[model samples]
Target: MIRLSNSVVLQDEELDITAIRAQGAGGQHVNKTSTAIHLRFNIQQSSLPEHYKARLLAATHHLITEDGVIIIKSQSYRSQQMNKDAAISRLVTLIRELTREEKNRKSTKPTRKSVERRLDNKNKHSIVKTLRSKVRRFFE
Candidate 1:
């Protein structure tokens, strides 16, 4: 079982994992051994809560397909078991991120002191700029 949070846990049956050949340069061993792991989880068919499923389907992650299937490929590790573990962990992280509640931003007005300070600075800047103008002689 994969634990997402205190209340959410995913069963092993929910994930479809497969072993595939790892890409890139790794000598002859890379061509002979299948060290990569491919994990697929269907959000609609899974036993996850409605909110979790909704959040996952609504997510814009590249791993998630239009049909609500999350596909994760892990090939960084040398061993198949390690790659599988990495894929599962990544899936768990993605679900946790998607389902997590976001805190709403509270709008606040500027403090009186801050506003006063800003006005004071603007006034100082205006005075400095005004002083740079060419002086006129009343006699001329």
Candidate 2:
């Protein structure tokens, strides 16, 4: 089991890793060897909690495909083993991030003093702008 958090855990079989050719400057080694790792995890079919699955789907709509697969491409390292490890690490990190519960924001209203201060600041600003206007003689 892949432990995401204290309550969240994923099965090993859920992750699918495919070896692919890595791009970029690597001389002839990049073309000769398939070192890059393509990691896929099906979010919709996984054993994750409903709330977590919903949030994951909502938060990572770009990453998740129409088929509900989460694809992660890792080619940072040259070695296949390193790339595989990196992909798995990324998957764990992503899952961990999803599992962590966000702090509930408490609903708050502006204090009476704060509201009064804001009004006072607005009045002061208005007065400053009023002073910037051209003076006019009313008793002509």
Candidate 3:
């Protein structure tokens, strides 16, 4: 079981790990060994809370498949074990992010002083424009 938080625990069976060839660096070793890890978890099938699932889907649309599986690939490490661990760590991090509640933004109106200052600036700009205009000599 993977403990995401104090309340959230993920079952081991939920995660599907596959080993694939790592891309970039290591020359011959990279071409031969299947060191990269591909971790797939079905978000809709998981025991996670409905709200968390919804937020996870919304936040991680790129990671999710059309069939509702979350795909995470890791090739940073040389060994398959290291890549697997890295992938799982990423999954936990993503889950934690989804679970954390966003702080509600307080709706605030512009202060009276700020509004007055803005209007004052506009009036000053208008006055400056008026002075720059070519005055027509009506007597001419």
Candidate 4:
């Protein structure tokens, strides 16, 4: 079983791990060895709370497939075991992120002093523009 957090635990069978060849830079070694791990977990099918499932699905549209599977590929490590562990850690991290509750923001109106300051600035600007206008003098 994978323990996501203090409150959430997922069955071991829920994760599907596949070993695929790592991509980039390593040349033949990268092409030959399947060190990279591809991990897929079905969020909708898991035993997570309804709210957690909903939040995860909503937050990760790119990571989750159309069929509702969350896919994570881990290949930074050279060994297959390391890659596999990395994949599991990534999964745990992603699920753990869902556990946090966003603090509610209170809507606030502009302060009276701020409004007054803004009007003062505008009035000063208008006075400066009036002073810059062409002036005329009459002669008898």
Candidate 5:
């Protein structure tokens, strides 16, 4: 079982894990051994809560496909077990992130002191710019 939070846990059967050959350079051992792990979890068919499933399905992550399946590939580890663990951990993180609630932002007005300071700075900058203009001498 993979624990997502205090109340959320995912069963092993929910995940479809497979071993595939690792890509890129790793010498001859890489070609002979399947060290990569591919994990697939269907949000619609899983035992997760309705809200969690809904949020997961609505997520726009690259790992989540249009069919409501999350696919994670882990190949950074040298061992298949490590890769599998990494993939599962990544899945847990993704679910947690997608289901987490964000606090609504409250609009706030700037403080009077801050606004005054900003206007002062703007006036200083304007004065400096105006000073840079070519001076006109009536006698010349």
Candidate 6:
């Protein structure tokens, strides 16, 4: 079982892990060993709560596929076990992020003092600009 959080635990069977050979240049060892791991988690078919499932699917547009499967590929490590652990940890992290509730923003109008200060600044700026212009008098 993978424990995502205190409330969320994923059954081992829910996760599908595949071992594949790591790509790129790493000598004969990389070519011979299947150190990479591919993890696929079906969001729609999980035991997760309905709201959590909806939130996960909505938040992770890049990670979740159209079919509601989350595909995680981990090949950063040299050993297959390490790669498998990495993939599982990544999946847990993604769900953890979605579990956090977004703090609602409080709608507030500008304070009277601030609004007055802004107007005062605008008045000062206009004064400065007016001074920059040639002073015109009735003597013209």
| Pick by lDDT: 1 or 4, better one | 1
Candidate achieving higher lDDT, 2 or 5:
5
Model number with the top TM-score: 1
User: What TM-score do all the candidates reach, one by one?
Assistant: 0.91, 0.79, 0.81, 0.77, 0.83, 0.87
**lDDT tens per residue, model 6, 1-140:** 98877877899999989999888779757667899999999999999988889888787568789888999999998989999989999999888887678899999999999999999999999999999999688775
Give one digit per residue, the lDDT tens place, for model 3 in 1-140.
99987888899999999999877768755677899999999989898888888877777467777777889999998878989989999999877876689799999999999999999999999999999999988996
Candidate 1 deviant stretches above 4 angstroms: none
Candidate 2: worst-modelled 10 consecutive residues by lDDT: 58-67
RMSD, every candidate, angstroms: 1.4, 2.5, 2.4, 2.8, 2.4, 1.9
- For residues 15-98, what per-residue lDDT tens digits would candidate 2 score against the true structure? 888999988888756678999999999999899999888877777555568777889999998899999989888888876676
In model 2, which regions exceed 4 Å deviation? Answer: 98-101, 138-140
Superposed on all Cα atoms, model 1 deviates from the true structure by an RMSD in Å of 1.4
lDDT of 6: 0.89
Candidate 3, residue 118: lDDT: 100
Better of 1 and 2 by lDDT: 1
Q: Candidate 6: minimum summed lDDT over ten consecutive residues — where?
A: 23-32
lDDT string, candidate 4, 1-140, tens digits: 88876877999888999999888889656667899999999989899999888888777557678777889999898999999988898888877776568899999999999999999999999999999999867775
Candidate 4 vs candidate 6: which has greater lDDT?
A: 6
Per-residue lDDT tens digits for candidate 5, residues 1-140, read 98898888899999999999998889867778999999999999999999999888887999999999999999998989999989999999899999999999999999999999999999999999999999988895
Where does model 6 exceed 4 Å of error? none
List candidate 3 segments past 4 Å from native: 25-28, 57-60, 98-100, 138-140
* Global CA lDDT computed for model 2: 0.86
Residue 2 lDDT in model 5?
89
Clash count in backbone of candidate 3: 0
Residue-level lDDT for 103 in candidate 3: 92
lDDT of each: 0.94, 0.86, 0.87, 0.86, 0.93, 0.89
Candidate 6: clashing pairs of residues: none
True-vs-predicted CA distance for residue 65, candidate 3, Å: 0.4
